[model samples]
Target: MAGRIVVGVDGSEPSLKALTWAAGQAALTGDALQTVIGWEYPASWAALMPGVPPEFDPERLAKQILDEAIDQALTPAQAAAVTRTVVGGNAPQALLDAAEGATLLVVGDRGRSGFTAAVLGSVSLHVTQHAPCPVVVVRGRTGA
Candidate 1:
């Protein structure tokens, strides 16, 4: 059976690189490409804000980020072949769920987090340790 490759993407530079790498791997292996992005309210949302805006849509924003990342990272035809998934919740769990049946799970060494010096971001570290499939944490400069 043909395989499916799942990749976690945020609007980070490392994530963009990871997406591009995943796309190339998928193309080489003829695997279906699945790109997943997850979003949720900030932990301090209720504490920091007086009221939640009705117009605030985390899922929509997440989808927009994912879409833009795909567009920026891949060609038009390559982007069209991508299967986009917007998940509601934490990125690590979302990626783990999406990679449940995948042949491979790919992620950037670091995401949009502030920890640039660390070799792996929290999401990448978590997924690499827990993913069901073989995990590849794409290494690169973790700036931005």
Candidate 2:
């Protein structure tokens, strides 16, 4: 059986960079590349929207973000080979849950600034500390 590499994508610049890195790693190692994305209602969802909009769909948006990230980061063949996973809830938990039995987990730094920029972003920090498998935090400037 082939190993699996799980990567979190949130459609951010850093996430796109992470997706590219994960795809390249998967290509080199022949691991199954799975891109995971998550979405949740904001804490003030009810306050923001008294009634749900007919066209509002967080799950569908998550899937589109995942797909766009893949398209932005990978070649057609690479994108085709990717497994897109959309989950409900936050990114860190989604990544950890998807990483079960994975050979590796990868994430972006979330492109923080100042003192925070020198350190891992909250999601990256959480996953690095708690991932079920070896985690690789892709670090670099965004849009570079």
Candidate 3:
């Protein structure tokens, strides 16, 4: 690989799969792997709802999620991969922004829900359409 391999993670099973695939690709290509988690806080009004804490920080949550995902996705040998968390208006925008100079951008087919078929998630579809670099949508190893 000529540059870093960027992978988008969202704390979902499919995203974890993407992370794993990216890590392997990076190792094989002798390129750095970057795991990016994107998050956006709910509006102030939404946070003001009953029982919702006002001090919640979306960026912090994103970082925490990314760290956890990285821990789960990488093996001990792949621990040297670089990881990053991005706070953006949306996942697609953050991923696209990170893909600017990347050798390849990896993402999951479906995340959290809507995995009844092989369809890509909205963010992944958007990234595939607009990413500056090549995009890879990783599904399960068994092709489920």
Best by TM-score: 1
For each candidate, the alpha-carbon lDDT, in order, equals 0.91, 0.87, 0.81
- Best-fitting candidate, scored by lDDT: 1
In the predicted model 3, the residue pairs found to clash are none
**Could you tell me which 10 consecutive residues in candidate 1 have the lowest summed lDDT?**
135-144
Runs in model 3 deviating more than 4 A are 43-49, 113-118, 141-144
| CA shift of 53, model 1, Å | 3.3
Which residue window of length 10 is worst by lDDT in model 3? Answer: 110-119
lDDT of 3 by residue, 1-144 (tens): 257998998888889999989988987888788877777655775656666676877778778888888888888668554767566667889888888899999999876654566467788888999999999998744543
lDDT of 2 at 75: 98
Q: All candidates: CA RMSD in angstroms?
A: 2.0, 2.8, 2.5
| Tens digit per residue, CA lDDT, model 2, 28-102 | 999999999988898999898897887899999889888888998999999999999999998889999999999
Q: Where is model 1 more than 4 Å wrong at Cα?
A: 50-52, 142-144
**lDDT measured at residue 139 in model 2 versus the true structure, 0 to 100:** 71
Per residue, candidate 1 scores C-alpha lDDT tens digits across 99-132 of 9989999999888873877778999999988999
Error of 2 at 23 (Å): 0.7
